[model samples]
Target: MLFAVEVAIALFVRDRFVRPYLGDVLAVVLVYCGLRAVLPLRVLPAAVLAFAIGALIEFGQAVNLLDLIGLRGNPVIAVVLGGSFEWLDFVAYAAGALLALAAERFIHR
Candidate 1:
């Protein structure tokens, strides 16, 4: 499952590309799939929501949200919220959204 893969990447991988970019891409997909599993979400909306969530988190990182909330020192929060911001993350999120849309179309056809 995508969650398992995300966990594995988070726990084990330290590469420059896979851990960051690929993980981000899969993250959006995971979010989309998760939303679909629980809610009556359409594919495009789910993907958009997923990308929005990730982008919001990334913007949070840009503003150092965890530190402002006094949670930067918390390891769990640090991991979940992340610490750095990158424009490429937006690209990865978009890619993930498109990939999720494509996969949904492929699966339903």
Candidate 2:
């Protein structure tokens, strides 16, 4: 599934473009989908929740919570929690959520 591919690229892909940006973009989509799977949120709410969660994670990175919790040394935790903060990643998450919302609207219309 798309989530699996995104996870693989996010973790394994070392290319500058795909690894840095695309992974962030797809992360919101994955988060949105996961939220929808458990919560009965509409597209907009799901996307919003995804963006909020992504922002929170970015904030966590800003504070070095991963390092505080000893997750920084683990590759999987490093990839999932992110090692450093980037403003661009917030933009990517918003863009990805917007795209997902638009697609959902188009499909459900």
Candidate 3:
């Protein structure tokens, strides 16, 4: 569900905020959900792992990982790996991770 919303925003949302910030936030939540689905990770660990993965990818974008590996020309890979870096993305990722953590605890408790 979150992944679907993220993809929809990616494909159609051209606004400055939604596509970038909200999409980034939801992307982290989606990753957290995926982690929980496959691994028996508790909420905090999973959220931390998800946030770390997002931060690592953001760093990768900062260093131009796509161009280094020669995949920058590929559109899909570019979208998946992200084409550029934004420091604001770190905030979004953190917000997402926290949202996921709170959501899990709320649902379980």
Candidate 4:
């Protein structure tokens, strides 16, 4: 279900708001859910891992890893790895992690 939402957002949403912030947020949520699907982890750990991975990806953008790896010409890889770095992406990732944690708690209760 969540994976579907992530795919929908990836394919459909392209406006400024969705592209810049919501994409980053949903990216983290997808990561969180993906990790949960694979491992038996507490909510906090899953969220932390998601956020950490997101941060690392953003850091990779700062260093232009995609260009170094010659994936800059690939649109799919460009979207997945991101071509540029932004501080707001970190905030969006954190927000997504918190939302994932809250949603998990709400659903469990």
Per-model TM-score, in order, reads: 0.95, 0.92, 0.96, 0.91
| Pairs of residues clashing in candidate 1 | none
TM-score of 4: 0.91
Candidate 3 at 25: error in angstroms?
0.4
Estimate the Cα RMSD of every predicted model relative to the unseen true structure: 0.9, 1.2, 0.8, 1.3
Off by over 4 Å in 2: none
lDDT of candidate 3 over 1-109, digit per residue (tens): 7878987887889998998898989999999999999999988999999999999999999999999999999988887779889999999999999999899889989
Q: Give the lDDT of residue 82 in candidate 4.
A: 88
After superposition, the stretches of candidate 1 with alpha carbons farther than 4 Å from their true spots are none
Residue-wise C-alpha lDDT for candidate 1, range 55-94, written one tens digit per residue: 9999999998998999989876787778899999999999
lDDT of 2: 0.88
Residue 51's C-alpha lDDT in candidate 2?
Answer: 94
Per-residue alpha-carbon lDDT of candidate 2 for residues 1-109, written as tens digits (9 for 90 to 100): 9778887897578997787778888888889989999998987889999999999999999999997897788988888888899989999999889878987889888
Residue pairs in clash, model 3: none
Candidate 2 has its poorest 10 consecutive residues by lDDT at: 10-19
- TM-score of model number 1: 0.95
Model 4 worst lDDT run, 10 consecutive residues: 1-10
Model-by-model lDDT, in order? 0.92, 0.88, 0.92, 0.90
Residue by residue across 1-109, what tens digits does model 4's lDDT show?
Answer: 7667766777887888887798889889999999998999988999999999999999999999998998899988887888899988999999999999999999999
